[model samples]
Target chain A: MAKTPDSPLRVIGTSVTLSSEVQSRIRADLGFAIEFDVLDGSACLRRGVTRPDSFDIYDQWFHSVDVLHTAGSIMPIEVDRIDRWHQMAPMYRGAGLASGAPGRRQCVGRDPADVLFVQADNGLGREPTHQVSMLPTVCNADGFAYRRELAANRSGPESWGWLLEQNWGARCMLSQDPASSVTEVAMAARSAGLVEIADCTNLTIEEIDALFVLLNRRRKAGHFTRTWPTHEESVRLMAQPSTGLGSLWSPAYFELCASGVDLVYATPIEGYRGWHSGLCLSAALESAMCDRAYAYLNWWLSGAPGAILARQGYYMSVTEPLRDVLTPAEWAYWYEGKPATTPLPGPDGRISVNIGDRRAGGSYQDRMSAISFWSTIMEESNYLQRKWLEFVG
Target chain B: MVPSSERRSSSSRKTSDPIAERGGGYLYAMIHDLLQDKIASGALPVGATLKEGTIAAHVGTSRAPVRRALRNLAKSGLIRAADGQGYIVGKGAAVPLSSRQLYDTLNGGIGAVDRTVSAERIVQIVHGAIVAVMPFGHYRILESELGEHFGVSRTVAREVLWRLMEQSYIHKDRKSHWIVPQLSARDIRETLQMRRALEPQALRLVAHGLPSAFLTDLASRIDAVLADFQAVTAPRIDAIEHDICHNLFEDLQNKRMLASIRRNQIPLVVPRIFRRNFPLRDDLAALRLYDRILSALVSGDVDAAARLLEIHLDRAEALMLARLRVLSVLPPPRTDTWLSAIH
Candidate 1:
């Protein structure tokens, strides 16, 4: 099916990982028609896997690789085709890179590295291979952001339980994302001594029922009425004084802090919920469009775009490419866990990091190592989503 | 109040029951397809004026469903409306068949039994649709919508819901909402345990009285499927499963045991619905397992065949879960007018 050259290369992803700024930049640099569509987390994953003919590229969580690969929704991404495969993070390579270093400890949840490689059987596995289901693009460690007024100078490591605390009642927001939000709530329930779960990622139906019972009780008491579905909505809510806290991403947190809210992105002693985003070609994308989609994937690793993400507190898959792109001061503040000597402007040209401000949780290595969960589609994902609806009610 | 016998007979005469086919579509669908088949076969000749009452009596249904079938056919331009009453069979041909000849032809040709599509059929159709989507997520079934969709009364729709409720396929929550619950991993495993315990015994009962020719026929079908599974269609796969789950139990007089075993066959619905919407990617696991079971049965090794069937159930339970995981990522391709996803 040959297409007219002017037909845009449509890319679909959640709004958190995509921005109009990125769209404008890519269009200007590549000089082609590009369609950027933002969908809810589940909607994006659904269309990505089931309706590959709808878009050229899918940008979403690596956690989806299992279902995506199993459905054959995505084509195998050739590592040889990647411009900076060798420069990419070892953590994302395979099982061999998962040892004897600062990243020595194995991940607790569904590690992106574990399912990174496309095995000879055309399934995802930890075994190293040349082909991949997706190209790891951006990543971050997530937790809720809170107001200084809500904390009141309380000084120990923040607790995930703070989300369920009565003090933040009604003012507190919940994530609209079923998988990510439920994991956060499970951690909070576990941390607060409200419940004991064997694995936060994989909860039994009884456990899920118990957690939702508590959540429903709290919701009836008006504890978590507000929820945000997108990063923009998250920032909008967190920037308000009435909204004391909720689950959040780093970009939204930075946006809130930069807008001068005395916001604190929590580093719960429990651990951060780590998540990674990647680019995948739709099974339907072919020939010339395939070449263009690959070009778009390569552009993600072109250092400039990765640096843009770094400004918002995200780590690229290949950090080395970003070293020269980001200033020394900027790199030290964001990735190396140092206080900023000067105000750091985000990709938007706004001073997102104020003078003397330090990154939360610490550096890339510190936060990532402390991760206890990764955003993934659990085996009980369908059940979780079903009950998640009952709670969100 | 009406007498109980009168009420029951009144419902039986409602024909093309919405209660029996809210989302199921057994009676009317059969009528539509049968009439279309007749038209295509030249059994309903050119310019045959299908009067509502005549077609209804001949098909053992009410004029309402016949009128509906004719209206639908007219919409498709397969037939056209006559000025006096009812539809003329040909789109353009206008010489009407005499009423006597039309009645004689329909009476002699169509074999729709009076009770072939009554309450029991409703159980099958509604149950099948319900089971197919149970693995996807929780869905709400509304009585009013069900009634509206099936062109049945609310009380009839409620009766069908009650039958499904008795089976635990659906339930009325505290708010009186009809809910088809999601099949969790625990549910799948628990259901599988029921299948393993009952199916082996069923295989034993059926295999003991099974004809050599019957077993051979089933084996040949399996062999053909194994030879080139890609050539097999979704409906063909469903038929193959029915051969084991229903047809194989033809000799088994234990209706309760057969019902129990078939209830545990909800696992089949996942792959059935999935393969129908997606391409048939030949897992061949079912074919291979059935081949082994058939060989045992063919050798008069009834106990061995039962053992193999138990193993087949084990494999089925796992594959069902895997298919559910894959299906979870997509919105169900089939949703009823009466059914809505809870989320």
Candidate 2:
């Protein structure tokens, strides 16, 4: 598409994070024209890196900071321009890990903070700086979800091992994203004693080879129903009565719940997979449109957007604004580990939670503290991609 | 130095230069020297037939030069035209040499370890061919086919393999076959890191000795690419990288360090591989970095030039690694005649 000097700030991101409702609100409140292009995961990353001139602001997971920053596709976001800059210091440094987690200050691979801060030398680093790679937005702990009625055993502590069992047969589903799917598969395989993996976040060549070799055998035996890339596809595939379990994100899980599907989010004792999404300023953005971009970045930390994300089970960076927009019942049920006082709405404004029901993982802090690994690109990510594609083939 | 007929001897006396004596070019002189040595040594026996193509293939040249050499030999009474399309080694009328005799003459007792098929030229060509398709997958270099393709002995092909191995471009498998290893992200990262650390050190070493005229020429190349980004070609980008990453260090004096720097220039090859299927975009960002480094070098700011080279290497490693991951889905190109996919 041709863009002019006075064109609206063009934002590109996955449907997982970007929404039409946010576009409408940003257009009305920011007093500027806006356009959003929602693509699947791979297409969004490809477009963002290969053609930075195509968009103004990019919204996606922070794992892409290394890719986007290295390509010079994104510009630095000045922390000073953020309204609650000092107030959000704890979260900026936290990188979605709660202070009480098992390894309180240790992160094995990448997190939002690992590549978030901009150094004096104009490079990305972990230490806090006046500039950052992205403005941290919606983050949450994700886990596998399965049909409660279809599962063989329902009365015990759930294990990640169940997804790989032969009983699930062809009813099992998984994501096509290698970063998340590889880690999730390794966790399941290790839990089942099928293979031993030293670390899930960063995989070695031998471990990846071994995992895929075994996965190929399992896959050939009809262990997987299918693989999906977008949340919408996940919802459509998992809605089938015959589908047993699948790797799922919050949005799809909540959508299925609202549409009245019987499924359970298994917060395995092993832990939850943590992910953080954020907003970025494009390197090609015209200087005149920068102030409006800052307003939009600060707007994410304000009240309304965080509440909308909360309906999809995501927590914002600063919790104060979210408290104002959500009901006391919604807040307690979603953040305080309490039973729902009444039915809660999904992002689509449908009643997704019933009265007297409790979330599988408890409050926001409880889920955040249980994150086993953040979805990240490994040092051998390219090799892993090659092997993963061969396995899929 | 073998004695020819009096006519040949007189011709040699008339001119000290061998090419002038032969009335042909350098290739003709080379072919002449080779055939005369083989014929005088009785390697090509009295009845052996020497075809133009046979002499050409033996010395790794074209028929034109070999024809000149053979014709000159015939005029000197060394070999004469036979009834067939070849020449007879003996001057007098005689039966043409058997094909078996010619084969034996040309074979020249070549052993299993033949080592010199224009080693310098072959290594350069093979290295480039390997790098172009390396990102795809592991490839087995066929020694026999390599020899046949170059019209050299297997020993010469093996020598090329050894040279490639010394440069870390290929490896010997358990079967002792020469194989080019698959290119991986880690390979790209390590190469980039090595270049980042070494190139700046190299620039500092050779900076003072670099010629202003040479540096000016390189700057012009960068400006040419910048002048029209859309019109840039792969070979042009390659020449620019070669001038900076490679040719600039000819006077560095540190052999091991220079070799290491050359090894790390594989990032320059990644774009060439991709350019085969996609057009290269030499946009302002990369070219400006090149311009800045050259400007520093031209101004005698060695420290500034070195610093800029390090930054360039860092950015290069990241970009190359990403391109490699994108190409991971496609297997290595299967088009090379002498390369077979190991998988």
Candidate 3:
């Protein structure tokens, strides 16, 4: 039970968090060797709940908090222990941005209890408390990426409706996951005048049916050439000549750019799909393991990891800390959406952005403001999955 | 109306009945009891016309007492006033009375004609039907219809409604109609969370005090299921789930904890609903996990058993949530006849 410098800290997360830079930094800064169990989305959820003792830390999206809390698989972290707890963006602190516009309604709600904050009595509350179910980490607005040549031929503003355009034929790709893909396609269906879903996050049975029917029709018509299950595959697909456009993650967009692919990560007039990722502690952690878990969580807030993730186009929950960690030029290029003054390294420590290149959306706030919906496991997700599989087949 | 020839034939058939000598208040009470029995047994079909003179002639009673009896039946929602005339049996008039409902209505001690029904009994019948149909979506609970169906006064029906409101099961809508809110995913998760917290703790409290032989037997049953989980039938899985999650802790003698745990039993009812559309996949992992928990309990390691119980609950919650998501897309289940819609 005694603490040791070489004690292994088991971290369970998606492949995005297990990047070489992120893993190496945790080992270097936290002074403990890290063991990672990188998994896909469903596997991560299954392991997080059923095998709490198998890992010390979980880095995943906020949507999984309900499942983890319901399972009692995660213990609340003391906000006092997080080094930059107060330094987080005002949105996390119950304050809206300067524009007075709200964050994505799917994730953040008007009530403090609606978010991840946990009170001492083990109920979700909005006001700051000693305990939090999870610590918010890297987040960003995501949208589709398309080949420059394909966009040059199109007129007018870019739209999510374009994904369903017969013009794209079988050249377009889509994400294979149900949670995000369903929301993305629903937005596209609505924008394309195919269906009008009331709430993208909690789709009803009828809306799910209509959306899937539309998707299936397009699938049978050979509208989609392929589907990408991972960000790496998504990047590869978007970089190909055959793929005119597809649902793309920020990291994959950066990866595509690093490979010198001429692509435009669109700020679709309709809106960007938003998502946030965070860290949670396993409830099984006790004594020294709890201490090491806290150390790993605090290290995530210490600016270095945020900076690394920022290079991949993610906004750290606490951007102030990242301001010092990143160069002024890199900050202007990434957060301000200004042209890069000089070449900048991607998350993988390779030059992905050259001088005079600008982000697609004007600024981080502007992009976050236009979020149409966030990735979520909707109440209708099982229906979405079954239909999604049929479309895939 | 009863045909004239049939009425004359039925009058001769009634001579053996004991009610022929009953008079005054007893005569009307006897008629009411006889009619109640007829309705309960579906002798009177829904929407069947019941003319005052026809029933009076058939039963060898004056129209006065038969009139009073029909009025009582109307008040109870078993019969409604026909257009401009006599009464007709209501839609749910033929719904077989539950034994408990009957016991509550009947004077069990003396078998006397006391027809007073408690609010609690009415609440139980209505609550059972509401919980059954609520997973489908919003439903209107007609106060008048409910009163008639349960053979209670409006005041008595209001008492049942107020009790259901206290439990957060049903509420009055804008039009003053009682509505059962749609069962949302959040509601399911919240209930499951409470179950995960309370049920495992309940298990821990009873594990040490439980008979070792009983624990061993339960463990062996679970082990047999786990050994061949892929071939296990749905009912077998349900039996094991009920034993561990519910039946085992029934003897804890802690009513508050047990009651709270019982209130969270909605998830337990979901498997049967989903099995209607989808084949129940054999979840070997859950079976194995439950087996471990039972084995730990059998060995008297309460802490390990409680821990494993938590894990099993987590898995169950996930499975139930997934099942509900699929079930949500399907149309609502057929409404039982006992459930009447106001709007």
Candidate 4:
């Protein structure tokens, strides 16, 4: 892979401090001479390229990966050694293929889900695999990042709860992407007796409307702040005191914390949501490169270098064997990452799971179930999105 | 304490100062500081009636300096008055709700309340409310009844009269203000139907994405409504319920969607009477739906939360229909006819 910096084959990712550091670490640990091009992962994802010949790997939200896979541009992998890879979360195992001939390679890497890239301000990591196409990657822990000064001035997490309360809805800041649909889903789920939508396979209008009405209350209360068009805008909004409450990933946000912006990153005592990102080799990549990509994937999933990085400041989807990377202080900060688990909507107002359930290693079927649920939501997302636009406009 | 000669010299010194000499920057600064203090102290309340002659006398200055200060206050929304009323203390004597209030009146079923509000009462209240604060010469209201109120020529009254109607604040027929029209249950339902279609998604996005403080504020506001609802007597509940919901809808418009639901929809629904007695059942039902919605939001169940909103609107429309039947407000609901066309 002797390509130039702008080589069509170079995979680009939007990333910040920890991720950039991870990139350098991967280059050194693997001792690969190949140049790794790292850009803003979000921008590249939005570009939405499907041809594997042009870019060999993509590290972004897994939702986009599924979209690309559906487009038939990325090749899928079915290496026999896949079983050897460490599967921390079942999401790492990849989803079953529903279309195209069997054995057509799809998804190259082991766990793009665990990538450290996140929007800057809130530091909430990119979409967790659970919320997107299932891939074995890093599972992002959700938390709040506050401007150090503003956070210090406030008593504690309780001050931020004001946004979630009756009169304070407009003061909170969050990502507005239709893809990461967490904050909206969480509010709706809370209203629907804590029924999570991402986990459920089917959803009805009543459940959707209940969520909408709850949101409407917040709007009526004068609590909403701004609807950022992109993640970067949200990050910038979070970074300043003039703006408030950055909802973002743990590792990614830690870098912002280290830089001296006072932010409090916490999972709601009632549990917030996370977006899962992972690698899915498309059905179109060259077999040899796909094999190499799979090797890298397996290596990442095996959890040595990734574990070391996680110790530094990140959460991986697949359970890893790392010890002592995160100190007690860092662990306290990290423990709240997945503090609240949410339930997904099933059918007829029924729910599939409770948000409070502890997440553990997923059974093999978990990956498929999650994907099936996500696909269903995406299928109806256009309609929901249209309604959202019409309603809010 | 100074001698007359010294005083003359000091006065001359003032005239010779650079700010006074050219840009009058110092003079402006002094006046600004004085005005700022008066405003901050609430001594010079916004819209407090002011006369040019009195201000000039009080400031011990010519009308020019005072005029500049008035202009600045006017720009800041701190001072306003009716034409010939001079400067008042506040901005536009409390906008109450602008034309959006007409929406609430319609929504509250004003026409159907106990006795018919006579055209004379309507004209007096509407004209007094409008003209009491209307800037002088803003429009000429030529309607004869209104012209009689202002003792103005019919030509001037007609202009102002038509302007109000055009803004949808009021409606007029050949003889009287159109207090009642082709208002039907179907029209009100159709209008509400549009709100149901548009508001829920916008609200979900806002609740999902709004900053923390806004959310908390919302929760408290909802709680306040709950408190108010408990406090009101059953007979007076409808008005209170309408007020709380109206404020909430306005806030929603301001925060998200940015669409004026009240301005566009309330007018059509407000004038029609509730067909059902104790409209509070519908009102309470609507309020409870929102309460559940807020809970879901705190819990983070976006889909279920959104679904509830749709259900709430549907139920509310049903309640409206039932109330309309009680009041004999429209023909019976047709099962097969499309609702949108009726509006």
Best by TM-score: 1
Docking class of 3: incorrect
Q: When only chain A is evaluated, what TM-score does every model earn? A: 0.95, 0.94, 0.91, 0.58
**DockQ score, prediction 2:** 0.17
**Higher-DockQ candidate among 2 and 3?**
2
Worst ten-residue run, lDDT, model 1 chain B? Answer: B4-13
Q: Summing lDDT over every window of 10 consecutive residues in candidate 4 chain B, give the lowest-scoring window.
A: B334-343
List the TM values for chain B, per candidate. 0.65, 0.69, 0.60, 0.41
Between prediction 1 and prediction 4, the one with superior lDDT is: 1
Q: Rank the candidates by DockQ, best first.
A: 1, 2, 3, 4
The sequence of per-residue lDDT tens digits that candidate 4 reaches over residues A1-393 is: 553433222454555222544666666665544345554443454333423455566665654553343233444344344544444443333422221223232221212332222223212133422222224455443444444444454443332243454332126655455444434344335434544443322233454555556656765665555655444455566665555554554443544444445565543433333345555553344545554555555655555644444433345554434334433332333333342244422111233224453222122122222221121223223224433443343
Q: Write the per-residue lDDT of candidate 1 for residues B165-248, one digit (tens) a residue.
A: 877789988999999988777777787899889888888776777766667767887888888887887656666676777567
Error of 1 at B10 (Å): 34
lDDT of 2 by residue, B162-194 (tens): 988988889999998888877776778778878
TM-score (chain B) for candidate 2 is 0.69
- Reference-based lDDT, residue A187, model 3: 81
Indicate the docking level reached by candidate 1: acceptable
- For A84-158, candidate 3 gives per-residue lDDT tens digits of 787776677655322236553333211212456786545454666677887888777778888887676789888
Which pairs of residues clash in candidate 3, taking residues 3 or more apart in a chain or in different chains? A112-A126, A113-A126, B76-B148, B77-B148
The per-model lDDT (C-alpha) reads 0.76, 0.74, 0.71, 0.43
Which regions in candidate 4 have their CA more than 4 angstroms from the true location? A1-9, A16-18, A31-53, A62-69, A82-135, A143-170, A182-222, A227-234, A302-313, A318-321, A324-379, A387-393, B1-343
